[model samples]
Target: MPSSDKTPFSRRALLAGAAGLAATSVGVASWQQLRQPKARVLQARCDSYDANLVGILLEGMAAFPAMLAKARGGHVVLKPNLVEVHPDRPINTDPRFIAAAAAAFLEVGAARVTVAEGAGHTRDAEFLLERTGLDELLRPMGVPFVDLNLDEAVDVRPPANLTRLGKLPVARTVMSADLLVSMPKLKTHHWAGVTLSMKNLFGTVPGHVFGWPKNPLHWAGIPNSITDLWSAIRPSFAIVDGIVGMEGDGPIMGTAVPMGVLLMGEDLPALDAQATRLMKLRPEGVEYLRQALELGATVSKHRIELLGDVITPRPFDVIESFHRLRA
Candidate 1:
């Protein structure tokens, strides 16, 4: 991974240089330094999940002042991962995390907050919402519940410079949202490597256009598809739920390890970088983050400020499918 203290490169120059390097070698470290991203990251450690909801909500809110500030009176859309069907599984975003965020938005005087998601693994966004306790939590708040699955479809063309991706399925409501707050669980993915803020957007893309009914977008490729989706609809604020993270074969089928941390960011790459550190993995070692860096995402720690509790994240007991780092 590139040192956080390394000299900063302008966006244009970084892309040009990275393009040349990627064409020649694309070493994990070189690819790790994305020029700069538009997102800012803040992290906090919640010692216990048993704290009062109001207090917890405030703490969570503090990490994302920019998001709340921007969403003062407008409609805010909250997207949580509902890729799988098990709520107790703890492999996806926790209901408490989503509920706390919703409550905070209201407490801060936001006009309306809508929690939305499109389930990729099941036709049960509604079920996932209920079982996960998000539906019950948001209903009384009088905020709307949106299933992106039921939303109208919009076609997305691949960017000219990119390859591997062809087209995508996008949700009309999500695309038009005034503010997007990402609530993703911290998990290791068999395909994408690490599933963080960028990978959370997978639920926003419709299956119809991206080959869900016929072809699963997973065929488009893991990290590549991840970056493409991020480029399409980057979230304004990202709040990662790492309370009980999944390790070793996740997004599903992993053992839950308690990390008790929540990460907030506007920059997806930086968030991923921090999450990588928490997982005891090198941010530059992850393929997608490096790819995002090359594509102009922010991976520089100097560009971000860390707020709240600071501690070293322990590496996962056993490395999984990721590339081994060069020490």
Candidate 2:
């Protein structure tokens, strides 16, 4: 059922809105002058969620963005992995990280920051919010949450020949944001190899149009859809929650692995590539990322410049068992 309280964002409205993106001035200008040099990625060692997450976030981003200056004032949207809520399981992006992120963005200087997700599994986006405790978690941070599942849909022209999917339905808020952050929990998946910053984008589409579990995207082919979404949305930053990450079979229903490090980068493919390296999995081993590589849009080893901590490959605790499934 589509949301009764609000109307869906139509194609005409989104076109008008996207045209207005040029007027944002600060962020749009930044993009115009944006430089991607050797695709640098920064890492910070954080043993546990109890560590000074915000401090780690700050130190690694010392050279982050000029928008950090208060006068520039821009809007930022945080897209965290909130697929399903099981308090005992390390299933979603840790709320603490989200809180730390909200604080960090404000401290640096963002005029507006919102948390948005269109959880694919369940239909009750609100109940899911309460069950996940995300509502309470974000309430104190003064960051508002938008249920993208019901938020008006907008027509988006995806990259040609990227996927069988042509124009995808995207949330208007996602399209309008100045800086969109892809915040994902590092997890191994039965089908996709592993879920990282790029896969986290599944939540940005409205469930009302796509249906529960985002079936249309799955029908379009997971690898194809992934490449298409990453190409179109093009997130400004990626922050992977690797602290107490899931190892076995996941995004959900996986065992937790205590690999405590946060991965940060401006390039989505670089982050995913670095993520694949950290997990000791070959980047070419993941079908979607390899497909991304073919498009000349994703990161290759030569394109990445690692900063902060040394790259240490974590043990693939349960990959041996699930590895054969993808084969």
Candidate 3:
């Protein structure tokens, strides 16, 4: 685990440099151009966790050659949703799926892949990892796991400070990654409607700075914080674990709904919009997603080009407060 220097990097400078590198290496004018008019969102039917996820993921990645080219020889950091461990509830992203994602990225030429997360519900990352089976699954593969909660912190201002919080303290592991891939579980959040890739970024904020459960961001506002975080971090891509999702009063305390599908795209907002639709909920009902559109995030259904398996929309049960979110 190499450490990131204490020096802060501006969001604009970091994104500009990344965009330039991508354009030079892949012959794309910019990430914006590559995703404009319509962003390609791949949906694959992964019937079970037993399925060959790596091959399915590779096939999905093949659809976006330029994205793969950009990832070649780069260090990739996978940020998965890991709130806590529950015996019966599906509260976290499945470790097997994370392993499969790491394998897929390596197959596509990523120099290295590291799994990192700052558990909001618990500071016991070692216990959480052991209980969730991530340690056992990833250690054998030599994939290092970083507890962002304890990692060195760096203060970076978001391009758009939607939350009005001046500088956000982020973990060094996240800031130094050549590519950041958000791997969120497809679950309903009691506060945010659906907790997809954008909301999953809550784990990136160091608990050491923000306190357990990252209360400051939540108090500032979940939706605004989500938007601000995305603006600052600009994750390179998102791969949603929808094979098994939680519905009804979630992010915790929900029933599992086996969606049996995986969704992927560079446009996080759009990808989340599509996932919202898959949950048979209205994307507009998700506040941050709506804000993302108002702030120029693309990928409306009219603008999203779907690739791979065609999945029929399934209705997910939401709590009383979120009934309006149902399509």
Quick one: best TM-score, which candidate?
A: 3
Q: Which stretches of candidate 3 lie over 4 Å from their true place?
A: 1-37
Predictions ranked by lDDT, top down?
3, 2, 1
* Candidate 2 segments exceeding 4 Å error: 1-37, 66-72, 318-327
Candidate 2 TM-score over all chains jointly: 0.84
Report the lDDT tens digits of candidate 2 across residue range 45-111: 8998878888888787665664254213788888898888777889988888987887778767778
lDDT of each: 0.73, 0.79, 0.90
Q: Across residues 1-327, which tens digit of lDDT does each residue of candidate 1 receive? A: 567447587678889998988776755544443446445666777755555645665775666767778778877888988776664467768777777878777788778888888777767666777777777877887877787876788766646214355667678878777788878988877776678888888888766555443245556566677777777677788888887788877777877888888787777788888887788777777777777777777766655567667856866533355656311
lDDT of 3 at 91: 87
Residue pairs in candidate 2 whose N, alpha carbon or C atoms collide under 3 angstroms: 9-153
**Ten contiguous residues with the weakest lDDT in model 1:** 318-327
Whose lDDT is greatest here?
3
What TM-score does candidate 3 reach?
A: 0.88
Residue 216 displacement in candidate 2 (angstroms): 0.7
Q: TM-score per candidate, in order?
A: 0.82, 0.84, 0.88
